[model samples]
Structures are given as C-alpha cells and as structure tokens.
Target: MAKDLTVKDVLYALEYMRDALVRTPISDGRARWNMRLTGASVKESVANQVRASGSVSGIEDTGTQIIVWRVAA
Candidate 1:
C-alpha cells in the first residue's frame, strides 16, 4: 500500500538525504536525488527547509516532484 508522508517524515527523509550527500558521494560530491513527495502542498513548506537546512543546494519543483541536490555543497 502507498502512504502519504507527513511534514515530520519529510524532514527526517531530508536529514537522511543530507547525511547521504554529506557523507557518501556519487563520485566526487553529492549531486542530486529525486525525492518522493507526501503531497503537493508539502512542497511549499519543505522547499524552504531543504534550502535552509543546507543539506542540499536546492530543489526543482516540477509540480509532480522535487529533486534534492547538493552539487554546490
């Protein structure tokens, strides 16, 4: 079954992504990953947190999904 993620779940997932990007690298540095959204509305709030967390460089919202990246980091 599929489940919608809550704000808290998103935050934790972001933390995990941050840790992965910071610690593990695709090759030289963290590039990006396509993160699943709990809902469309979650994008508005989480986008800022992702940027502010500095876990990723930024995100690309395509209405359908958000891609978390750390290319600059």
Candidate 2:
C-alpha cells in the first residue's frame, strides 16, 4: 500500500533539498545542476540559511505531496 505524506515531512524534505543546494560549491557543474534543480529566482537569491527555506518552498508546495528528492538530512 502507498503511504501518505505529512506536512511536516514535506517541510523536512524541502529543508534537505535547500541544504544540498547551499552545500554545493559554486562551479560549472554545480551551476548546471542548480539550473536543473532550482529556478531563476532561487539562483539569483543569496544562498543563506535564512533564505534557503523560503527559496525551496517557492519552488514546490510541500502541502500536497512530499518532494522525494529531499531525504533525511
């Protein structure tokens, strides 16, 4: 049976994805990956702890389904 996702779970997932993005070094490969992962606005925005959560949430609404990409941090 399929399992249901909770809002808290989604929030946690977003946090992980955001952290991964933050940890990524600024390089050509990272740039390409960033483009694929995040949007124009996110790339433009500063990658700080405070801003990362907002940025990740903007990309996807974790209210419905949990973003699987973001595993447990």
Candidate 3:
C-alpha cells in the first residue's frame, strides 16, 4: 500500500471489490468483516461505502471489525 493513502483511496478500493463483497454470503441479514487491525481509516472507508451502497440498514464498526446489518438480498 502507498503511504498517505486517504479514505477516498480506500473507498475506491472497496468499490472495486463490490462484486466480491456481494458474493460474500449474508446470513441472518448481516455480513461481518474482520478487519484485523487494518486501522481506523480503512474501517471508516468501509462504513462510508456501506452507507453509499444504500443496502445495509445499519453498520457496526469496532475499529477492528465491521458487522453490516440488514443487507438487501
């Protein structure tokens, strides 16, 4: 990863991975992502992406992992 990568950059990465994320199974209306110390900026980018997706009803970020709730099937 390049130094000085901003949330916008991370968000772009997430956008590129949208197909993969969509393929990830969602059980019980939620999808969990284990971020594993990737840092706050990446987590924030994920939250912002989820919000922009307009599919998930809620988002829970623990600064390490993310649990996206109520994802549209």
Candidate 4:
C-alpha cells in the first residue's frame, strides 16, 4: 500500500530522484496558465519547508520541478 508522506519524506524522495527528474517550462498559453500557477504554488510550499528544516542543503528549480538535497553534517 502507498503511504502518506511528510515534508521530510518528500525532501528525501526529491533528493533520491534528483537525477531522474526533469523540469520543463510550461508553454505560454492561456489554457496552461492555471497549471503554471499551481506549479509555482507547490514550489513555494516546498521552499517554505526547506527554509524551516536545516537538514535540507538547498533546492534547485528546473523550471518544471524542484529538487531538494540534504545537508551533510
């Protein structure tokens, strides 16, 4: 069964999938504006989480997706 993911879990998953994920900019079409807005909101939410957690090293924006990496202590 699939499990619910916490913010930390999501961060870890992003790190693990970094290499496999790609970000592509949405096309400049009115129909796609909503999707673009939704993506931006999700990115902002992730960014907020990263800022709250010192465990996260940084985030990379691929224009299509965000990747989170852990900080090495």
lDDT of each: 0.42, 0.33, 0.39, 0.40
Model 2: colliding residue pairs: none
Instruction: Give the Å error, residue 69, model 2.
Output: 13
TM-score of 3: 0.28
Q: List the residue pairs that clash in candidate 3.
A: none
Judged by whole-model lDDT over C-alpha atoms, candidate 1 comes out at: 0.42
Candidate 1 residue 55 Cα shift, in angstroms, is 0.9
- Among all windows of 10 consecutive residues in model 4, the one with the lowest summed lDDT is 29-38
Candidate 3 deviant stretches above 4 angstroms: 19-64, 67-73
- By TM-score, rank the candidates, best first: 1, 4, 3, 2
Model 1 scores a TM of 0.33
Residue 46 alpha-carbon offset, candidate 1, angstroms: 3.6
lDDT, model 4: 0.40
Q: Best by TM-score, which number?
A: 1
Per-residue lDDT of candidate 2, residues 1-73 (tens digit): 5343333433443555442222333445342112224422232223333234543422333222122232332
Clashes of 3: 0
Give TM per candidate. 0.33, 0.26, 0.28, 0.32
Per-residue CA lDDT of candidate 3, range 1-73, in tens?
6464454444444444332122122457554442223432333345456556654344334432333333322
Off by over 4 Å in 4: 1-6, 19-43, 59-67, 71-73
